[model samples]
Target: MQKLFSLTLFLFTFSLSQAQNKFGNPEVDPVQIQKTYEQWSVYQNKNIMLSRDFTALDVSSKEITKEVFLDQLANGSFIPIRLKSDASVYYYKLFKIQPKTDTSIKATINQIGFDAYKNYKMEGTVFPKFSFKDLDGNLVTNESMKGKIIVIKCWYIHCTPCIKEFPQVNKLVEEYKDRKDIIFISLAEDSPEELKTFLARKPLSYAVIPDMKEYMNEALQLNSFPTHFILNKKGLISKVLPNFESLEVALAKESKF
Candidate 1:
């Protein structure tokens, strides 16, 4: 978890799954090290919160072992994220534990929601609001996405999976372009010059919006490319579709306005 801030890291952070290190212990080692992500999977789908105060106290005087994410107690049992290494470490836990299920179905939703959290509404409270520029360089707010069911595909050209998924995404866009009840947008992390020239001749006929790096960074806590979210007519985030097939399913499932 390379945080937006902080450059120093610790190596032994993941071994302490059940221990708390609130204050500081000078005896602990201090050297730059990458945080371990092994323990993250255990708490992935469980609603958990990160506590900076608790982490500061633990690693204050010693070398930090891993990067962690913090959340309000009310945020949710678990949150979606990439392997975190930068945010301040926060002690976390699942609000409600779920029973173990078979591996086949587990893999399906883990792709949908982190740690197989699809059955539960993540956040129970917050929804995503995007602010990006339209082709004309006008700033677009989350409210601009209302009225129509909006599908914003976060992507990059180099992404293998994304390249494979483009045609299907384009097809969905073409099918719904005339409906007026829905809209499709393809967003990429690359600069307009880089993406525009490449996609100009492609079948993607929807209005391609560009320059939302800051929005994507915050909403997904990810600088990595090719992430997308689907917004329902009520302006609530209905789905986070990270791939082609999933994106199609979300579009097909939209409740007609």
Candidate 2:
């Protein structure tokens, strides 16, 4: 079975040779390859600590095949991305009859979460202080944010989940659009021009701030995409929403404060 699986994989990689490299040794057991993929899935959802350097050592731990695959996937050398309406999916383009497509194969490679940092346990802590000029050059500061319920969302133009969640975020902005006590701010890693182009096609009413990746990394220690922070009236961090699904629940908790 292992020899047959290896032969199958070789034939598949041969077809995509122009696009990707062989991810594993031909002699490598198919069972081990499958295990490597499974380990990557587990790391993405749970054990991944993005605050540290993201490397093969960080991703696969002791598994050699997993490490090689993780490196190739990160560098876009082996996998091809498929964008779907519901979620962005990845497939082993070079590996034939592999686990992602075959249930019997048991090897799975899903969308990796390099920036899926969930270390924001600072709910009761004071929100980190900073100021930046919005896209319109309006100076936004923690001082200005004080005495108001500040909604801060961290996103980038290339983030699929971030883009998908924009409509709901916009609705949340509209619900409180009439109120001066509530402020909506988005901190993006994109430049002002990139944001301008994206927002032209898909408008977001929030006060969009650009070039905030450094602030996110240094101040917030965020290693993930689409993180939302809610600062209460006192400017203390009230709730931190990690993904789009947490928006409503985070808002519910914020409503009481």
Candidate 3:
């Protein structure tokens, strides 16, 4: 099924970069260290070639193969966020080794810094206006959101983390359902039929709009999956949370009731 395919892709992508082996020495300044995250390829029967961004950390073995690196990471030999200084090093493991042509293999790795994503505090900034039809064919726009605390979530059916947090999001919606001034809306990246089928098996309490990816991306400039935007009654952006847990905390503090 299409839904199953989406779920599989999400899991594969999440696990793919978590298998890479990259370690930073705590004794060195983070700025002095290089190759926090990199992609690599191996050609011929020779040596592994890392991308320009990568400089190998001094590890136990310098002659280890990519497979060996992955195996060690999977076996818990290397841990994420190993070194801390001005920058925190989180090594995303190499999850795959795919042969390209005859004599080459490509590998992917991610290096995330402690401040990779700086949380945006857009409070007092005017919320942008965008329109999309909810599942019930009701038009949802900034005008519709006026005089209310608007909670808008940008999500898709295939995102595992988004689905994992759906229950908590649903609970939050249920808790504020009775309040006329608080509205929870989900702009899903799926078509209406897809959402209908998916929701039949896994239901959510928020007002869901299907096939709103275009408007969500172009109008709201939201590209991140499972992003939440909270707007106050004055239509000002109050909080922009990347996950439902943070949204829950924001809701509690800025409750409209």
TM-scores of the models, in the given order?
0.51, 0.55, 0.54
Native-to-model Cα distance after best TM-score fit, residue 245 in candidate 2, in Å = 2.7
Q: Write the per-residue lDDT of candidate 1 for residues 42-111, one digit (tens) a residue.
A: 4332322221123322222232322322221123332222222234433322122133423333343234
Query: lDDT-based ranking, best first?
Result: 2, 3, 1
Winning candidate number (lDDT) = 2
* Per-model C-alpha RMSD: 16.4, 13.8, 18.0
lDDT tens readout by residue for model 2, 71-156: 44444323221111221211222233344534422222322322222333365688887879999999999898778988889999
Better of 2 and 3 by TM-score: 2
Q: Which stretches of candidate 1 lie over 4 Å from their true place?
A: 1-127, 201-203, 223-225
Q: Each candidate's lDDT (Cα)?
A: 0.49, 0.61, 0.59
**Angstrom error at residue 193, model 2:** 1.2
Task: Report the alpha-carbon TM-score of model 2 versus the true structure.
Answer: 0.55
Task: Judging by TM-score against the true structure, name the best candidate.
Answer: 2
lDDT of 3 by residue, 46-135 (tens): 122121112223243133443344344334223221232233222222222222211211112221111112224245588767777889
> Model 2 — which ten-residue stretch has the worst lDDT?
81-90
Per-residue error for 202 in candidate 3, Å, reads 0.6
**For model 2, what is the alpha-carbon lDDT of residue 96?**
30
